[model samples]
Target: MRGRKELEKYWGRPYTDTRDWSIYNERLVRRGEFYLSLDFIDHWTDLVSRMNTGKPGRPFHYPEPFITWMAFIHVFLQMPYRQMEGFTRKLSIFIPSLVSADYTTLFRRIKRLDISLRVDPTILSRNVIIAVDSTGIKVTNRGEWMREKWRVRRGWIKVHAMIDIETNQILGLEVTDESVQDDARCIPLLDQVQQHCGREHTIRRLLADGAYDRNEIFNTLEKRGILSGIKTRTDAATRSTGSPYRAECVRERVRLGGYREWAQDIDYGMRWKAEGVFSSGKRIFGETVRATSKEGMIREVKMKMNCYNMLLTMVK
Candidate 1:
């Protein structure tokens, strides 16, 4: 892959928008107002909030629905607690619920929220092909200036995501520290799909990579009657390991000349869609997490995913 400097020529250095902005100025301005137009976005945040009922003690200042909405804004804007607190404070007059909000309140609400991202209904209506992959998210967002000034390097957290190929929407997600292996996440992601889609939902295919080539992983998919388009590593034990299902996958690749041909035959190249998911995530939300503690790290990543689903729902 080309580094940023090397890729500069491809970006058309002296860039300009070819489209006429004058014709679309009003529409573009209205589009940017989506965030300020709370009523327009309320439907999305309400769905997640309504799932959890309010507590049974002396009442809280803000309802769960309001808490849920504000928390999501934190992720959507990729803002820190202080920035989020200030943002809502400015809007306090427009929204009565924001009058009492503070950074700690927003923090606590997200920490406790039990997040579940549903498969889009249209995607659910038909069979699914899910792509599974993982990527590293850094602990801090340091631009070139900061890196050069401080010579700083930070640790990363791994995000395992399952994307519904057709919808191009994340169906489920898991986050862990950098030490966790990619293979460890495969089964958990599959289980999440089963939970969301139910027995009636047919999972037609599974796409993954060489890291998930273990025996149990293949067998698990076999039991579900899913055809796996996992790119297998070439090895002599290809004949000896696991069940015929696994061996057949390898043999088929060997027979088709090589990995390239096998991929083209089965549309295995679509596995890169999972990679595209990670790239889009990092590009939209920045490639780092702001949380310091383990639990906080997990919660922050999960909130980003929940925000992704909400954005997908709203756009669709």
Candidate 2:
């Protein structure tokens, strides 16, 4: 006791304010609040509830913080769970909130999250103009069997997305095997959008490329009483006259050159936005690829997309 006091006396300025000694503590509190306000913690809690894990031990310590840390870590660093765990541990002293879970715990939780969790797209935007497109992601090893025989890649997954043209928010998303064609994926994606927006026929015009130029797609839009602003393909002539719907679209596009140009510009310009979204997702959230099974890969894809949608909701 006397020894410590003597040393303190020798040192001129004794430590008086423990709280004021470091700015990191204050920064940690603010950082945690920022993540919480963005609903990161709430989403993680929801995911954990669905996990229904029966690990049976004393239960993982600080599960909520662990999950929250994992989600934010995935988004910010865009690394796999193993890498994330290592990075966090190495840097844990700098980020107090990240010291909760190790790699295995975090990865197990991520794999347990349900792929079917319904993400509400209406939260992204209410704008009438929506852009639709699909981008490919490499699938897990189990999906290798589904790859096209002629294709060089082993297997791929397609993420069909719809974004608000005005705000660049992701209005809708669907993850499917890469073999699913763009036209085939559209109807379901549209249904999802309709359900979330709660509008019987709110989408005024859908902007898409020539890949969506089929008569059935046009008819689907027509049935919904929504205008299809998708560009008509030139090669469609082979299928145009034989089908009245294709002919009708061609005739309509031919009649309105200005409308055609406007639609093409809108479709082309907005297509890039979807690509930009994917780029941002991969760059910021590490949405690249992972699982070794088809189901796991799909789950991973949906989770990543949901995370993107959540981030969009935050920024908007």
The top-ranked prediction according to TM-score is 1
CA lDDT scores, all candidates in order: 0.74, 0.64
TM-score of 1: 0.79
Among all candidates shown, the one with the greatest lDDT: 1
Write down the TM-score of every candidate. 0.79, 0.65
Tens-digit per-residue lDDT, 125-168, candidate 2? 44467778888875534344555664546557788888766656
Candidate 1 lowest-lDDT run of ten: 40-49
Question: After aligning candidate 1 to the native by TM-score, how far in Å is the CA of 157 from where it should be?
Answer: 0.3
